[model samples]
Target: MLDELRNDPVILSYLQERANLTKGKIAEKLNIDTDIHTVCVHHFDYIDTLRMMMFYLFQQIGLNVVFYIPFNPNAPDVYKTWREIYERVSGCDYSRWECVESSQPNRGTKFAQYLDKCFPHQEDQLDNIRFLSFNHPTEFKEYLQKNPIVNNQNEVIASYEKDLNIYTDCTKSDHFYASRYGKFFLSLQNCKKTEDGIFLTYDDYVNMMTSGWVQYGSINGTQALTLLVDLRDYMDGVESFQNIMERLQSLVYLQEVSQVFDEVAKEQAGRHRLKCYLSNPFRCFPYVHQSRYQITVKQLIECTKDLARKVNRLLLAEREKKNVQLYLRELYKIYLTVKDKWEPSAKQKIEKLFSIHIPDHWEFAKEELYQLLTFYLGSTEEQENKILNFDQLIGKTLSAENIHVTGLSFKTFPWKTPELPSLLTHTWLKECIRCSFIATNQNIRINALLVDYYSRNVTRSTALYSIYHLLAYGNGQITFSYIKDLQENDGPSIYFMILEELYNKEKVNLEEQTEEFSWEETVTTQEEIPKEPLRNIPDLLWLDSDFCQRKFFLNAFVEHHPVYENDFHQQQAFSIIGKLLAEQGEGEELFRETMFPLFPQWTNAHKQNLLDTSYSSGLRTYK
Candidate 1:
């Protein structure tokens, strides 16, 4: 066996590490006449198998041999395998020994019990045979009763110690243990204990090897961490080995556990986001009661960061290029919007790069919205309507202005005149028109065009006016006379329904009085104002307010009677005129001429009338 091991440097190294095994060292220790060769297998299973194999071989050759199971090896050993002992010893004819030794009782000790039960010999032969079980070796020695055979036993002790010391010496001086290779092997042994009290050995970890038990596949990793540490101690003076082991430890410890960690991190992030949302919830306000885009964005940001960190670690350890690129790309998209929202200073520079801005506030006028819409439209590909089906159309429209398209129709040629099957997609067109005309503040031509489109419906005009009323009021100007014209007219092109909802929902109290008044009494305030509906008077007058001036082209063609009247009267007149205008688009010469002069600036003063209790009471009653 020693000659067979001569060519294997690893085995030779293990052998040479043994101390007290020198031919001269053995003589100094034991002064024995016989030579003994010893081999060490760290595992108890292998040791037991090898011992049995040697027993048969030595016995067959008629060599006097003794076997001893030593104590306290480098690591805890596992139970022995029955097959290794059985197959190797089969040629020894165990049946002959069994018959001869059958009468002797078992050892009754757990470790040696098997030997006693399986190996029986004649009582006299058993008496001559020595059982050197170490469980109570001192007691067994005393039982020997001072037989001179003890002298030979002491020699065996010297022999065993000599072998162990020789192995130790070999380990100390062996270059393999002192080289970078030894340190590299040691590095794999770095691992921490699991919570369940299972000590994770650095090299033998099932999870690390298998990517979780390593099963039938090779997990290809370092040794148990503790074992590696032990190896490091063995190579203490070897600088190369020490460096290799430390580097390996660093690599293993640096591994990421992936996105699961990111989600755990979100608890901290959510608090910050909640604070921002709560500050002005309606603005940046969080929807505590339900999930919101802000929450999703936050999660995505965290995930991206975690993935980014992982890729960075990989780049450092393995230089995995593909992994680095994929993660970097994802990181950019995740940060694009979050940075804009969380860090406003970074927004301006990257604004054109991405449409990260949230939707505008409700107070945005149709004209401004239209311009924004146009800009957003230009950002995407200019495709024909077909490729962008109803869903895509709805999505783009809603995303652009927060308006939902709920209904559709094929084609409704011309506005105002009723057609079958609602030929045009009503909801889509309404939303688009609302976004363009109402939200963006398009000109009179667009307004006229909208009127033409919805010509079949008188209330559509009222709805249009109502949206304008809210915007005007929000700007600090209550179009009282316009409200009246809208009230008296058979539903003006602009209505106050939205204002009513806003007021009801918010419970805002407007001090202005609402009263019914004859057109004659109302018009006396501004004789030059349009004599149209009370609603028309405000549009007739305030149409030029900084807020209303932008979309003049939308309602410009609608003739205004340049005479001021009671707001209720004006509202009523415009409602009627709006109906007439909806049914009859662009051709009212008398009204057109009356409205001509009021063009640039049209609002009339009705402060005194607004203060009247009767007027206020009348307006409330009308609603």
Candidate 2:
């Protein structure tokens, strides 16, 4: 029958694929009636029919077979298969086969116990059962004690230590374990302690190999952090420095490991002790939290300095361009982490680090230095001194032709300092204005400095252009005293520039105030000021003090330009003057004395009436 079944293609394929046997092998095994004493069956989804058929064949041949079926009350098909197998095997002669029942519902432990019960008298048969089991820890402990790896206690301890040393060595050297032998050896080392000694069990070994740490022999910094975080969740308290370091060094880069150490030191209680341990590993100490691990401000600053030096060395080497940026950013982050812990003495070191220059990499380096300086030397005095020092340094290095102050804005340097303008050379000032004009957040300060630069070094076309550029874009409040000073010292060009601006502004305001008035229509009727330059104009006339100089400029303005002698221009000019004089409490005699010579066409009655009308609450008019 078996030979006939082998000729069937379905049976042949099932034997080859599922049972891992050829037709001839299956036939050979089927012919051996007495050789098969105890057959163990494990569940496989595809080979369920094959397994059942094989069990039925074995039962018909009066072979003792034990099927390890896991108890799943939720799975009715599994229970149905078990019942079928039980009925089929039990229906055979009861003397040749035996069915063992497990009292416990947990199928994990039941399989092993049921196997021992099925082959109680045959020690060799039980040994040859060769099945895997999942049992409780207590049951595994019982099995370990019954079957010890070593007969005595000393050998057990020796074996444990030997294996532990091997694991420690492998971890230290970052050695990859062998596929088969290493796994088996690790299993042996995963033994549980007993009253007599330590004993190995299949379940304990499996659990150890599957633990989060041992699952992956090697890990990186991020992975190590994940494992540490997981352990933090499971463990009750902080782990020891030795334990933490061993795991971290085995997994991550040495620098990353040091960073992790620093992180742990920040949160844990034994920071000083951990620091000492990391510094000198030869000294031995127990795993206890020591409260004396205080990190001083000076020590933190020195540590940050060391990191900065490392970054500097990388920069000096000019290799690892990618790592250079990354390390520089990280170094700055570390500085920020401990920035508040800076001592006064650490300023020199920080400044020294800041002074190191890397060509083409000066932007980020300057940014980091700016941040550090802002944090450490935050006082106004210290910042001033540092700015002066930087200015002197910059002045020495600044060239005549190529003045590329790209990153030197007000935020980067103290551009607003009064001394900065004096300390920097004229060439540097030009470059600073050019760079600061575009990059500064506070344009008012930059504009003020430009004005200062104009006052001192007015010869530079760049300074003049900077001042004019500021005025153009400065939102039209040209109220800086420097503008008046420019008018006094430089010439009337600034005065005319301001007057032109004010004229255009007043026209716009009048147009806005009176929507009925058209600017283009008014321009045709109003007299145009002649383009000839007006000379001998007093400087005080441009002053904004009490509108006195402005009124004076207006009077001088119409007198100098005869084309502006029309009634509209004269009335507008004299009306403003009358209002000013009335507000100043000047009598009509004074008004006549001040203005009749300026305006000879006006009668005394007309001038006094203009004055009286200007004093009225309503708008003043002239006939």
Candidate 3:
């Protein structure tokens, strides 16, 4: 990433003035201080800050930095993310630096046992830096694939706080041997609130899948344009399905292709779903297709016309009683020549359209052909649009006067393992468990990518000195605030435990909040439109009526809001249960009588609430 940035002309333009400057000249030009030394290191959460500091020291100021690192088993990603950030930063710019970590954690991790054997321990081993900073660190694996990963992170945040507070390689003192290491240990805390971890998390994914698209559509765009009357605009002079299909293909539409396949429901009151109709063609056709997406009207029309001609020839040959197989092969070849890979839906549709069979073994001869058709002719896809854009404000600590820090939520810290895609299990991702092999299908395999994307952040420093840098951006009047009972769909976490302990002091009168708190006092949020951003539900048994009923029950229960039932913690619990069911394929075959029993962990109240919802939603007479 750093390399890419350096290669970028814009970024290089930012650095060009200093590029030719010598070390002393660069220091003078950049106004960097050279006299900084005696750096003490804690967790390597933000390596960017460290790298930038080192660059100034070694490159401009010309001094080698000795880094004291710690290998915490519980926080290997701390090391891993450090390595990742180091690579990213140094790839563009870096300096000479060396690190000495716990030669042995002294306790009994596998790495520790190996190190303990390699070197002989002398008396007063704790005094040596090699044997220092090692503690009985917890394993990170204990937190993965929970009902949702955030639930697991609650424990992780609690565990890490303890690790920071009590444990060290040396004797526990008031300074805890702080000043002995560096004259000033930059005690940076993780407090700034963007989606935690460099890799995209669930919140980011959700943000991308909402409201609008990266680009809007024209022709068959928006809800108003979806009506049958609007189809004539693209049809131009001929009201043909082929004409409309040609105009719509590959072009972005605001309307989603209805998932419900009931043809009668599809033709509700004599038209397709009008919810996404392009209320104004002025906004749709020319602006969206011609201007926005850079797709001309002529291009869409020509593509569709070309596709129609091919299909008509096939139909004419069929009418003439010509060899249908030959035309079918040509059709398959035509599709293959244009498309990167053969799509199953394309194959199925073509076969069904011609009432012919396409053998899987047929390897159509390769040739270049302009594809005049698209798979999704009247559908909308999630065209990702950025929700938040932030500057790379990690380490430059020169600016001063006022600072306001935000996003101190648990969701943005301790780095919750992102919620895996539906119907994919953690066991499958980790060890390729075949007890229920998920990679058996493409949908499940694609979900595997989510795991890969998320797993990288496992070691990438999520909570770097971001908070420090944010505060340093404007030094004076530092202000940060977090709600005790935030409407984040969470309750008391380990952070709360720390607070409970703090408030337990005699000077403070606050007691441990063991009881349920009111939601109205916390935060208020409004209900928005339900978005089917995605679902990996197989087009298999879940499509069955009985199975659909069960799925409905599960989804309804997960999505149930008890009319102003605004308890965020309860919402979190509900959302978690929904994720567990989807990932584990639960409740799909359960009878109403046995459904509650299957979820033994769900409390009686939850079960009752679900029952109430089911009844109120007109799903009466549960067996």
**Per-residue alpha-carbon lDDT of candidate 3 for residues 1-623, written as tens digits (9 for 90 to 100):** 57866787777885775455455564566687884433344444433322443444453444444444333333433234444444443342223434344353332122222222333333211110110011112211111121111211111112123222232222123231122111101111011112221122222211211111111223211122222222333223322333244334522231111122222243443442121221211122222323233334444444434433433443332113334356456655644443333245434443443453534433221110111111212113331211111122232223323322222346544445445469865555545434335544433333333334433454214433233233223333433323233234643334323322322322122223488777666677898955563353323323433556755444334421111112333334333333333234344233324333323334557655654443121122112
Show model 3 residue runs off by greater than 4 Å: 1-45, 48-220, 223-405, 416-493, 500-623
Q: How close is candidate 3 to the true structure, as a TM-score?
A: 0.23
Best candidate, TM-score: 3
Candidate 1: count the clashes.
111
The lDDT of each candidate is 0.28, 0.33, 0.32
Tell me the deviation in Å of residue 115 in model 1: 19
Tell me how far the alpha carbon of residue 141 in candidate 1 is from the true structure, in angstroms, after superposition: 43
Q: Which ten residues in a row have the lowest lDDT in candidate 1?
A: 406-415
lDDT value, candidate 2, whole model: 0.33
Residue 341 shift from truth in candidate 3, angstroms: 36
Task: Please report how far candidate 2 places residue 11 from its true position, in Å.
Answer: 12
